[model samples]
Target chain A: MTDLLRFRTDAAHEEPAVSLDAFVEGQANASAVRLEAGDDARVLIPYLDRIMLVEIGFPKFRDGRGYSSARILREAGYTGELRAAGDVLVDQIDFMRRCGFDAFAPDAPIDEAVLTRSLERYDYHYQPAADAIVPVWKLRHG
Target chain B: MYKYDQYDQSIVDARVDEFRDQARRRLAGEITEDQFKPLRLKNGLYLQLHAYMLRVAIPYGTLDSRQMRKLAYIARTYDRGYGHFTTRQNIQYNWIKLEEAPDILADLATVEMHAIQTSGESIRNVSSDQYAGASADEIADPRPWAELIRQATTFHPEFSYLPRKFKIAVIASAEDRAAMRLHDIGLRLVANDAGDLGFEVYVGGGMGRTPFIAPLIRAFLPVDHLFSYCEAVLRVWNRTARRDNIHKQRVKILVHQMGAEAFAAAVEAEWQEILPNKSDVPRAEFDRIAAYFTPPAFEAGDREPDRADPDFAVWLDQNVKPHKHPGYAIVNISLKPIGGIPGDASADQIDLMADLAERHSFDELRVTHAQNIVLPHVRKADLYTIWQALVDAGLAESNLDLISDIIACPGLDYCSLANARSIPVAQKIATRFAGRQRDLGELKLKISGCINACGHHHAGHIGILGVDKKGTENYQLLLGGSGAEDASLGKITGPGFSEDGIVDAIERVTDQYIAVRQDGERFLDTYRRVGMDGFKEAIYG
Candidate 1:
């Protein structure tokens, strides 16, 4: 089991995540779901409002499929606890959060001080994404 | 050259700081090499076969004298006294220190430059036509748009981490000088029937294990929808591009497997979803950026250059091109001298080019995709003087588009990825054909160390791919491919050859081309006209 960092005010679910296949096939009654890198997030759109936790597996940090997966779920109105699980590094925290991952579950321990510093390093962004952070372009336009 | 705004400076500054911490952590053993690799690559520091190579972005291949001087300083201070300009219009220092990487980036930041997005899985430098504004045939200057795209793509939140590296090239003219069709996203600025300038977008074209000419996904995309439409394309590619096979992960493979039409349809669907967002930079923002690129005042003078010097006459015809404005010429300073390593520029040469750019060409210079330099706007009257200066500096090579003007990658000599060395092969071939390369006419001889095709052998008219065969270096020759408007992949001729044998084989192929080629037909044209049967027979028979 890995430690989870939750950012939402909603009641957290302690239930184990059902495999994406089981959940998509309606064979599982779980509210928490696990998404492998290859799993399509589009299939879970109908059940997004009901899901309390959605864990995206990053088998390797270099394999960036989970970033897109997290973005797709958030854009599709999956307001659940989007967690980035496995191989998550301190440097990738900011990008994962920008892609709508509000929770992190690293396979290895990350230094909290370094993670915090990295996250707060930049106040300006080039483009708007799954996050509410206003792009610098918007500031100029306004 | 686009100057960095407050937002731009902040982002770059923050990145340098982040990289500084990461480097420190690595030094302290807090991060492993596997973890440190991506972080270092994102900042353009690569641990190569011998040392760390730092690739600094020359955005859209455009840089001013100050930036060039800074690059010279970095080359002298950080590594050796030289740097290699890549085919992607970026510069790489061969012997960089990991400890000095952060300091180099900090130094780059002072000149409003950083290596952000120059490497890693995200977007590399957004390359464009080296002769952007000065070229006679361009519809509009492509650099402004390239700059806009550069800013938006720089440290882009969702796209910082991608399945594979993405490359974008923008061009505005009918003549594809920038290899527009050979990028992951190739944007050619065009005007519609309504006269509104937009782009004819091509996606998934790349040169690697599998070379492709990116299909036309959109015939005309309005300038307003540039980012949203791009987002759709990237998003689709991000989620759908194959991650299973490292070789098959480029967006080109996805487009190939899905078929062009189906890929376009998918992008269209995604575009519709994101259209309401209006993610592209506003008109005011574009105008602000465009203001930086507006050409300075020019004095009208004699259009015809004095051609009394025969050597000057040859160079004027070969190296000088007609600029958009009368009396102005686009000067191509070929880095390829006879027996010199392709793309290797000494600190002295870099500083000289900078001085020439400042004095003769409005303080602006461009690094060509073919590993040359261009002073985009020089008065025709100053041609003789400029030519004399280049001659003095050993920069006057009258071989633009000629056989001796080779494009070779730093192969086994520097790159860990290479199977065989490419520099010696290029030197041997160039030396062999030095006397007759001019007669050959427009032969794009490219070399790659391996199938990754950094040398762009796939797109070369006479291409060579170097590979490892049973612990020895082997070379493969290819023909009939081009990276121009009519882009096509080269086909392998026959059996591989040894280093010396490949050079001899090229001679035979070129000799055959001379015999069979019609009047005014170049190597590629002859290859296309007569087909591969003749060339293969010449090589084998």
Candidate 2:
């Protein structure tokens, strides 16, 4: 767990979310659940009120469904931890963060220094997304 | 041209720094090649057969003189002394090294250009007609809208990681010069009965191995609601478009599989939720972007015809197109210099063209989908002078839409994906038809070294596709395709040819076209009337 390059500022302090098998087995007591990349986020939307964490699977870095899943859950008013697990890498951390991925559990170890630099790569972004960073367009016109 | 403000400039500048760091990581082995591939591709870097090719975005086919000069500078410094303008109205440098890509991007940022999303499985550079603002038949300039869409989709979180790459083209004229019907999302800016501008949205159109003329999704959408509607379509695609199969993943396939009605229903349902309390672009933002694209000041005057030389007359007839302004002309500078590669322009030629653009075309120019450059707002009186300069520089080849003007992809010569060499095939064909170009009359000969159709062979009137057979390069010929207003896919004729044999086949096809006496029909028109049988027999029989 310590080897993972977590993008969220408070990722180290947070408890790990339950995997899909664990969640399914302990459905009544689970506070957090991990979902595979293919799992429809819409199904989890109804349960989002009580879920403290919603860990989405990446499966592969090139498979971008997790990004959409995180955005969907965030848009559906899920304030829980949206962790990107499996195959997450240093290069994807910033984009993952923008799409509401607050925690990461990469399958492989990442250089902490490289991950940190990648996260702070840009001060501004052009598109308005799940992140708090003000879009360049809003900064310009306002 | 849309001048980048502090924010826009900062985004591009920051991207350069980011890419520089990513390159460092890749070089240091912090990331594997598999990890670095998509990262570099998203930044418009490709590892080709010869070297890393860097594609720079020429947003909506428009660039100022400063940007043009910077492109020339990039060509001179980071790459070989030349760059290729692509069919998507973007430029690609074929001789880039991985180490120098960041520096090239940083240099491009100074001129408010970038390689961002130029080559990736994301929203590509939004293309419009090269003659977008200058064309006489336009209802309204589509540049502003194209710019708006470009800005919105630049780093869109949800869309950045879609199943496949998406392309959007906008056209305002009745004539679809941008090939609007052949995009993932084609927005035709049309006026309603009240004369207010709206979009005739077409979706799912594309060309690859599977070509589709995008069907009309929403016949007319109010201008203000465009962003939300577009988001709905993309949202539907992201969630539902096939991710399991890479080849069956474009929105076109989904549209076909789900049926247009069902797809429209899904989009409508999504749009309903998004319409209220939406993240759609506001009117104020639209106005702000639109202000940048306001027409340049032109002294209103009558058409003044100058005494033109015979060569100038030939060029005028071939390259010059109608402009909205009375005394202005849209000049297409042919990149297809006879027997040369179709779209390659040397650094010196680029610089000279930049100088010409500054002097005669209001300091701005456009890159056409046909791999030509446009001085979009050239005054009619200055045509002769521009023509003379172009002729002197060897840029003036009076073969626009003629037989010698071929559109070819960087096939086995550069592209790692290619099975054969398209440039040499194009070169030989152009040379074969060099003397008889004008007489051959308005034949679009497009060549792609593979089925990816990078050269858009599917849209060429006389299309040549390269293939691999038993470790040998083979060329397949197709006819009667078009990318213009009346969009149609070309049909392949029987059998493939060796490289020289293909050129000979093309010669025989043209010979047959000349033999069939039609009063004044163009090559495409004659082909459309005669069908593939006549051309097939002429080539194969």
Candidate 3:
């Protein structure tokens, strides 16, 4: 077991064991789906409710398709584990978490202390994301 | 000026603490240099040629007297005793140290300012017209929307790791002082036939090796839906922009390869999906932001305008801009001293300008996209006093929009990416045209040390691009470009020239314009009327 830190508040109590079964695209009966940087996230929307974890690949640190993929999966009502695998960095922890990513499988070892501190860097942000913290504008007016 | 509320205050304070930690980690050898590069860049710290350059945002070119004084303090204490105001409406210190970066940011946070997003592949500071609120010809003040956009785009989650850096420019006047047509996303506040305020949206306009004017994507979009529509556009760009090549990753390349019509269609499709509930700026939120921009109080003024001193009259003719109010005038402080760098100001000059702003222009000043400063609401009666003070301090150069007022990037001297030296060339040209600028009349000379076009070379009446040809510095000359309401790209005329040869070539081109020009034709007009052949013949024949 990879001592993974699950970030999704709503999905924390779910079962942690998820077999990495390969689900080829356009195949009908695979259990879970995987996405590359070039693949469209909408192709997995129909199977989101049934999928256990949707693994998105970040081939390079600068390629940001995983962030969009994670947001799209959550927007399509996926409550399962959305794991960001490959080439993830410690600095992108908060961004990945706010974009609806629950678990990370970075290519390098992540310092848990730095990761925790990074996620708590700003309690509030200017834009509304998947995180539940109120945007600063709402806090100001409300 | 927009004052920071409690929420704004807390956000900036938290960011300062966060960057402090990040800088600590980077210096402690915890994170690798590759991992820490983007982190520092997002906070506007760049590893340049000599040292780290810190670019602090001015937030739509508007700053208060206290903020200006703080900037002066930072310049005096942190780095050297000067700062450079860039063409992007931000100020840069070229000699910041890595260790003191956190303290500098913490000090900036006291005044609700930060270096955040001034660099990196994120949405940077949203710029607007420097004369936004005070211009007589404006339809409405555009700074409110600029502020709102800045708030919305700051640290946006999805677009943070963008394919390339993004920029947005907003303008309300028919005159294009802000160079709106040359930004990634340009918003013009326009009125429809029904007399409702709306935005005319333009996308993919940029200047680099490949220069292009933005194409209009939406003729008119309702003002209430501005944020949602912008979200839709950025979302579309974020999802589909080219990621294979860093050079081809800007939204401009997407717009070019996919065609504007196809890009617009894609954005519309994304917008249709996003508009239902993803993004919307509530009426209360809009009003709350707009409240900060309500016009300042004005008293009844004397009907007669002062026209007494000849020196003051000359300054008025060159530097004073028309105000929306009759008795008030907008004063533009020229940063382009004769044979000097375009926008470098010393610590004392910064403090003096701050004091001048507090006393003469309602405690606020604006930085123009052309790298000049503006005291937006100066009374006509105080013009003489202000002019005298400016003259004493060496800030009173009477060359607004003149040939000597050049826009130049900090080229080979400081920038790690420069191909040739731009400052020396600019100095040479300015000195060459010092006494002849008034006669030259309304000529904009722009210089870029490389093809990145930071000085907006493509938009100048005369554009000079410095290139390294076979281990020697060579320059290419272009003519007939304007960043005004009638925006057009300049055309290159034949071959390149050496540094001295290029200056002489420019003079030759101008001399031809002077000889064959009809009554009262500006350089651009005469070039447009006579076309490129006349200048080509003058230079080569």
Candidate 4:
């Protein structure tokens, strides 16, 4: 396994990710799964407790379906490591983090200083998401 | 106009800081242009023909004297002496710098303004009726709701990077002044049988290469479900909209493919799922926002407006409309001057208009979808003084809704995407029809430099689209379209014509209308009554 950003406490998985069909076939032993942009995240919700890591693919950075995919999995109570892999950039880090991406495996390596600056930039957010950041509206009203 | 609170202020301030950093990095060659383009575009900065064009959001077409004055300051300091108000009711500065763009946004932040989401493939600005609060025809003011939509959509986590740009419009009237049906999502505030207010939601209406009138998705959605319902709509489109073909990515195309019935059903199912989780705006928070838009204390104004001057009388006849309050009137300010740019407002003119708003209009002003301005709450007695001020400022044009009042895009002269110049064509058409403008009456002529339809040529009563024909510029004329309650797409009259020939072609169409029109019929009415058959014959022959 190549170097990847991880927020999870456990050691990184050594096994290669299996396809969604393969994971569903071996749900009892399957610990890592991969989802393409077109795969439905809802189908894996029942087996989320057994899975330790889920890698979602993005063929291009401009295709935003991966954000929706990450959000759907996290909001459905997936506590395992959610890794965003392929064609990601420093700019999308802030949004990907907000959408519950705990790990990143970009096709191109990102600069650590720029990544830190992007993630720590905004203290407030406009909308509630899968992340722990309270939406600006809640703070205002309270 | 809604004022930004401390929360709003902090968010805007943070955005300015973030943009400043991004601009610094882009300038220092840390990121490539392909990477920096989408980020700058989200903040309303665009690379145009000669310079970077910056589009500043005028939320729901509403702003105050203070905000308006700040706009003038930005125009004078950062840009050329003028800014162009767009058909979407936002203002565009054509000559912006990549370096100074961040400073411009910082300056706008001081006046409770930012250029966020004015462009790019995310949700763009939320527009509403210019006459939202003051008009008699509306069920209620739509500004508060527009502001809510504005806030919720800003920096939305999941739907931030849409396949194509999304536009949402909110209106509370039967008379459609904001081109509500031409947006990606349109909401009309209405009343149920129980007399409770809600929205009639329309999804998938837009114009570009393909023009569609949004179909009704919900007849009456409850008022409290505003955020949840909209979230459902956005999520459905975001997840399912085609990413393969950029042209077929808009929600309108998706709606057509899925069929309106199936699309609405999908939205309803998503909305039902969202309802159990409960993410709608709180009633108290909604009421808190609504309090800002309450009516100002209005004294009984003079019943009669002085019309001793013929120019004032003509201006009053065309530019003024009855407000809900009998004492006041809604005054439409014409940005279009014959033989000039349709929507260009100079620094001096902008300042003067701001002063007028401060003095006589409860400090409020609105930018209309027709690229005009409106002092929504004005005393009828102060009409003469305002007219004189406008006359001195070269803005007292008595051609409201007339042929000279054209809606045009900043075409090849400024925009990088344009195939021909829309402004020069608009200037020529306005000047040619100046003498007979009042006689022809209420011709909503619109021009676009390309098929992108930024000028809303698809909705014009007399639509002119400028196309690139081989190596030369060409223009096509279409007849019989309306963007009102009687909305219909226009039909092309004939083959293309030269730049000069199109102006003459327009005149011939009007001449035919005058010859065969019935009593009290406007140009649109005339065109609608007699279809494109006769107009095509006259123009083509």
Give one digit per residue, the lDDT tens place, for model 4 in A14-117.
77889888877765477888998878887888888888888999888887888888888887789888999998888888999888888999888787888888
In CAPRI terms, model 1 is classed as medium
TM-score ranking from best candidate downward: 4, 1, 3, 2
Q: Write the per-residue lDDT of candidate 2 for residues B28-145, one digit (tens) a residue.
A: 9877898888889998999998789999999889998889999999999988799999989999999899999998998888888899998779999999988988988999989999
Task: Give one digit per residue, the lDDT tens place, for model 1 in B159-211.
Answer: 87798999999999999999999999999999998899999999999998999
- All models, RMSD in angstroms: 1.4, 2.2, 2.2, 1.4
lDDT of each: 0.90, 0.86, 0.86, 0.89
Candidate 4: how close is chain B to the reference, as a TM-score? 0.99
> Residue A110 deviation, candidate 3, in Å?
1.5
Model 4 C-alpha lDDT per residue in residues B69-168, reported as the tens digit of each score: 9999999999988999988889999999898998999999999999999999989999989998899999999998998889989888787788899999
Worst 10 residues of 1 chain B by lDDT: B272-281
What's the true lDDT of residue A104 in model 3?
Answer: 80
What is candidate 3's CA lDDT for residue B377?
88
lDDT, ranked from best to worst: 1, 4, 3, 2
lDDT of 3 by residue, A36-118 (tens): 87777877777776777777888888888778778877877888888887888888878888889888878888888887787
Q: What is the DockQ for all candidates, taken in turn?
A: 0.73, 0.59, 0.61, 0.66
> Which pairs clash inside model 4?
none
Give me the displacement of residue A127 in model 1, in angstroms: 0.3
Candidate 1's DockQ: 0.73
